[model samples]
Target chain A: MSSPKAKVLLVGMGGVGSVAAYSLEYGGKAEVTAVLRSDYQTLIDDGFEFESVDHGKVNCFRPTNITKSVEEAMEKYGPFDYAIFSLKNIPDISPIEPLIAKCYTPEVGILLLQNGIGIEKPIFKLFPEAYVMSGVTMVSSTLYGRKVVHVATEHVRVGAYDNGKIPYEKQVAKCKKFIEIYSTDKNDIIYDENVNFSRWRKLVYNACVNSSAALTDCDIGRLEVFGAMDPIVRPAMREILAIAKSDGVDLPEDVIEFMIRSDDGEWYPPSMLVDMRKGNYCEYQVILGNALDIAKENGVPAPVLSCMYHLLHVVQMKTQEKKGKFVLPEVRPLPADNFQIKYLN
Target chain B: MSSPKAKVLLVGMGGVGSVAAYSLEYGGKAEVTAVLRSDYQTLIDDGFEFESVDHGKVNCFRPTNITKSVEEAMEKYGPFDYAIFSLKNIPDISPIEPLIAKCYTPEVGILLLQNGIGIEKPIFKLFPEAYVMSGVTMVSSTLYGRKVVHVATEHVRVGAYDNGKIPYEKQVAKCKKFIEIYSTDKNDIIYDENVNFSRWRKLVYNACVNSSAALTDCDIGRLEVFGAMDPIVRPAMREILAIAKSDGVDLPEDVIEFMIRSDDGEWYPPSMLVDMRKGNYCEYQVILGNALDIAKENGVPAPVLSCMYHLLHVVQMKTQEKKGKFVLPEVRPLPADNFQIKYLN
Candidate 1:
C-alpha cells in the first residue's frame, strides 16, 4: 500500500515560495497550503499569477489552500506534513520565531528553503525533537507587484539540516517524499545527502552575484563587462572558497569556474538587487554576513567576503535611510568649560 | 629682483580651487588667476563670495583674474608662475590633457592639489622640463552655488612629486614660494621633503573614510555605528597597509588608529560621497584602484582593497548608466539552425 500524500504548508510567498506553490499545484501531487503575510488579501482577492516558460501561463491561481498567517493556516489545514520556509533573512527582524511556533507539531517535519548559511540552526535549536530538513533552490524568479511572478529557471536540493539529532534514514525519507510531491516539469527537486555541501555551494554563487549585482546595480551580464570576472568576481569567489574550506566544507574544485560560467549571458538581476532597487531590506545578513561570522569563528581570513558583506550592509543601510528608519545622529556643540560669566551676564 | 611675485592660475573652481583662490587673495600674495569651467559667467558677473569661520563673510569680491578655459586664462595672464590643479580624478575622462596643453610653459611650475596617487605621472610625462609638485590639503570647505565657499578648517602639505626629475632645490623653492603666497589665516601650507610618504599617509584616510562614505552614502559619524570599524574599515586599512608596505612606503603605524579615533562624532561627508550623491564620477581609480594595482604587481594580498575598488566601480557604473552613457549588452537568442527549410510550401 502507498503512503498517504504529504501535506505541505509553504511560508513567505516572495518568488521561491510562490514558485513552489505553483509547481506543486500544477503537478497535482501534494496538498499544498501557502501562508502569505503581506499580500494575503491580494492573493485571496485577485489570486496568484505566474508566467512560466515550462507551463505556459497560470492566471489567478487560487491555491488549494492559502491564508494570511501560520495560525490561520494551521486552523484551516490542521497539521502539515512539512512546513517549507522560503522567507528572506533580514537582519534585526524577528518574525520567523512566531511563524515556526504556530506551525510546530511533533510529527510535522521542517524544511528551510531560504538562502543563507546555518539557517537551520535556530530552527533545530527551537525544535530539538523535530525532524528539520534544509534546502537550497537555484530558481531564477522575479516578482511583479503583489501577485505576479516570472519564473526563469527552477532547481532545488534538499537534505537534512546539519548537526541535527535526526537519523539519516528518516531525513532521506522525508526529503525524498517532499521531492516526489514537489517536482514538476518546470521544477527539478533533488534529494541530496550532503545538505551542508549544497548550502556552501549555493552560498558561493549568492555571495558573489547578489552583493555585486546590488552594489553595481548591474545584472549578471553587465557585471562581466570590462573583464570584471577576472579581477573582481573570481578573486572574491576564491576568498569565499577558502573560508568554506576552513570550515571543513569542501566544495567542488571548479565551483568558482562553474559559478562564473553558469551566467550564460543572462541579464537576470539577483533578488538582492531587486530588493535594493525597490528600497527594501535585503537578505544580506544570512547570505553573506552569516558566512562571515563562521569564517571569523574558524579563524579564516576572508577579507573579500568581509568586504562584500559590509558593502552590502551599506547598500541596505542606504535603503533604510531612504525609508526614514535610519536617521543620522545630530551634531552637538561642546560646553564652555573654562568660561567665567562674572557680572557681564 | 625678488623673483617677480608668482603669477598663479588655478584650475577647476570647485570647493578646493575656490578655497585656494580666496586664501591667496586674502593673504594679498601672488597674482591669483582662476579658471572657472562651469560657473565662469556667474563668477565674472557676480564676483566670488566666501562664508568662512576663519575669514568672515566676503560678498561679491571679484578676483584680479578669472577666465573660462585654460586657453583664455593663459591668453589673459601670459604663462603664470604656477598652474594649480584642484580638480577631481574621474576615469575615462580627459580634461587634464587639454588643460595642460593650453597652459604649457617651461618656467611655470605645476602644483597638483588633487587627491590620488600617480596623478603627477601624466603631467610629468607631458612637460618633461617643468617643475612639478604635489600637495595634499586637510582643508574643510564646501561650495555653495557658483560663488561661495565656506572654509571651516585649513591645513596644507606641499611636496615635490616624488618620482619626477626636477631637482630638490627647485621642488622646495616652488613649494615654498607657492606656500608663501597661498597661506592665509584660514590656511597653513607646509613643505615636506618626502612627498611619497605624505601621499601614502593621506591615502590611509582616503582609502578608509572616503570609500566607506561613498559606498554607504553615510557620513563619518553614522559609519562608526554597527561596529563597521572592526569588520569593514580596519580590514580594508590592513589590506591597504600591506599594499603600501610592498611599495616600500612606510606609512605611520598609528595612521589607521589615528584616523578612526580622530572622528570624534563629526558628521562630515567625504568628497567622494558628495560627488556620488550628485551623480558624478568619483576618484576611486586613483585612490583605491591604483593601490590595488600596486598590490597585484607586488604580489601582496589585498583582498579588502580589491573588493572596495570593484564595489566603487559598480557604484560608478550605476552613475554612468544614469547619465545615459552606459547601456547593457543585449541578450542574444540561441541559434535556429535545425528549423525546416520549407514551411507550408
Candidate 2:
C-alpha cells in the first residue's frame, strides 16, 4: 500500500505523539523519527508498549529512530517529507520558531497535531513559504512513560493551514499527502476544508472542560456531580462562541450541548489538569491565551475567556516559579512591631 | 465620656472579632460579652494578648464575660443592648437566622461589622422590626490563636441598614447609638448616612483582589509582581463598578485605579486567601457570590466576577470533599482492554 516511506519527525513524544507514531508506523505508511526529550533512553531500551482495542496488545513498538533532540533527529533523518509536533504549546517557556527552523526544508512541509487556536500563525510567520498542515484529533491515548494505552476510538480532522500567500491547491496537495501516511483503515480521518472552524469547535470543549477542572481543582466527573458544568463550564463555552463568531466562524449553538453530554459521565482528566497534577506547566497559552487575544482584537466581550486567560496565566507563572524559571516575591505578613500611624499628606 | 457603658455580645472571636471587641471595650464606653468558639478554653486559661500600635500592648484584654456558645452568651449576658457579628458571611454552611435568633432580644439591635453587599438582608428578614446597624472597616488585624496583633491604621464607617419597612430616622438613631459606644478618641470612625455607598466602595477592592489571589493560588503581592494587577485585577474592579451602577450607585472610575494602587505594594494575603491556606472555607459567598447574583439580576455582563464565583465554588466544593462533606466521583482512565466502538443512534 506504500508508494515510498515518508520520513517524519515527531517532537515531544508523550501521549498523543506515541499514539500517532504507533498509528502511522503500524499502518506501514511512514517511518517516524521520534524526539523524546525526557524518556529517550528509556524508549530506546524498552520502546513503546501499546494496549489498544484497535491493534490489540503490541509490545515494544519502536520508531525508525529515537532521538533526544530535534537537531539530533534532523542530523540522522535530514530533508524529511514532514515533521509533526504533538508537544504542548507553551510559548512563554518554549517558542516554536527556533525548533521548527532546525527541521525546516523548502520541500518538507510541517504538520502540527497540537491543540489551541492561532498556533499556526507563529510557524507561518517564521516560514512564510513552508506548507503547514494542522490536525485536530479526538484520540483517547495516554503515554505513561514507555507504555501507551490507546483506549479505542480515534478520529482526526486534518487540513491545510492558510497563510493567504500560498495557492490553495498546492496547500491541499501537501495536506492530502500527510493524510495518506497518517490514516489507517481503522482510523476515522476526515479532511477538513476549513481547519480554523474545527479548531474553534475543539476549543469550545477544551476551554470549558479543561479550564473548569484545573482552576477549580476538581476533575471533570466531580464537576458534573457538583452540578457545576452548566453554571461554570457552559457559560465559558458560550463566551468562546462569542469570540469565535467575531472570527467569522458560526459554531452551531447545539455543539455546546453535544460537548457537555459527551463528557457527562466520563471521569477522565484532560491534558491541562494532568499537566498541573504532574507539576509541569499547563498549555494555557494554546488553550485560553491565543483565543483571548482574538477576543480582545475583535472587541468581543469575552469575560469568562479573559478570566480563564488571566487565571491560567497565574497558574502557569506559578508552575514557572516552582521550576525556578520564575522567582516569586515573598509576601510578608504585616509586621507586628511596625504598626506606626505615620499620617501621609 | 460619662455615658453609661453599652452592653454588647461579640460573636466569632477571630482576627477582626478580637480587634472589634478590644476597640469597643478599650474605649471604656462598651462592655463586650465575647463568644469564643474553639479557643474558648485556650482563651479562658490565657486571655487575649494584644500588640497594638494605637493602644500599645494591652495584656489580658478580657471581655466583661467570655462564653463559648451563643446560647451561653445569651444566658450569661442576656438583654444586651447590641449583638455584633464579625465572623465570615458564608451562608451555605451557616445561615444568619438560626445564630441571630438565639442572640435576639426586643432591645438588642443587630450590628454587622462584616464585608459584603446585601448581607444585612437575611438578619433584617428574620428580625423585621429589629434595627440593623451596618459597619464597614478598613482595620487590618490578625489573630494567631491567643495572640492579637493590630497592624496600625484603623478606620470604620457605621450606618443604619434600611429594611424598607423601617423608618430611616429610627434606623439612624439606633446606628448612631451603637457607634457612639464603639468609637474612641484614637479610632477614626465616621457616621455614614448611606452605608451601601461604603459597602460598594469596599467591594471594589474585595471582589477584585480577594478572588484573584484565591482562584490563582497566588498572593496579591505575587499577582502584582507578575504585572497582572493592571490586566487581571483592574478589569474585575471595572466589572464590579458596572454592577454597582446597576444598583443605582456610581462608584468613581478612579476607585478602580485607587483600589489597584492601594494593593500595589502590599504582600499580605487577603482573608479569602488566608482562609484557603488554612483549608477553611473561603468567604466567597459574601465577597463574590452575592455580587455575582446582583450582576445577574441586573443583567450586567460580569465575565471576570462570574468566572471567580464559579471557580471559587469549585475550590470550596473541593475543600468540602476534603472534609468528607462531598464525595468526588472517580475519574477512571480510559479502559484500554474494552475499547468498543459501539455506534450510537
- By TM-score, the best candidate is 2
Give the per-residue lDDT digits (tens) of candidate 1, residues B1-345.
455566888887777777787777778777788887778888888877778666778787656788888888898887888889888767454448678878878777788888877677777667776678888887777777854666556777888664356566776777787777887766678887777677888788888888988877777665665346777788778777778888888876788988775656467677888898888889998899888878889999876677778878877766766676645436622123321112121
Error of 2 at B116 (Å): 0.5
lDDT per residue as tens, model 2, B1-345: 587788899998877788888888888889899987788997789998988766788888788889988898888777689998888878876776787899898668788888898888877667777888898988888888788888865688988888677687887888888888888877887899878989999999899999988887787766765556777788889989999999888999998867766754477677888888889888788888888889889999887787788788878877877777645335432323333222222
Q: TM per model?
A: 0.89, 0.89
Docking verdict class for candidate 1 = acceptable
DockQ of each model vs. true complex: 0.31, 0.35
Query: Any residue pairs clashing in model 2, and if so which?
Result: none
Q: Could you give candidate 2's per-residue lDDT for residues A1-345 as a string of tens digits? A: 538899988987877788888888878889899898888888988888888767788888888888988898899887689889888887878877788999998778788888999889888777888888898988888888778888856788989987777888998998898888888977877889998999999999898889888887777766766557777789889989999999999999999988876654577687788888889888888888899889889998777777777888888877777777744335432323333222222
lDDT of 1 by residue, A241-345 (tens): 877888788977698878875766566677778887787888888888888888889887766667777877766666665667645436611122322212211
Q: What is the lDDT of residue A60 in candidate 1?
A: 73
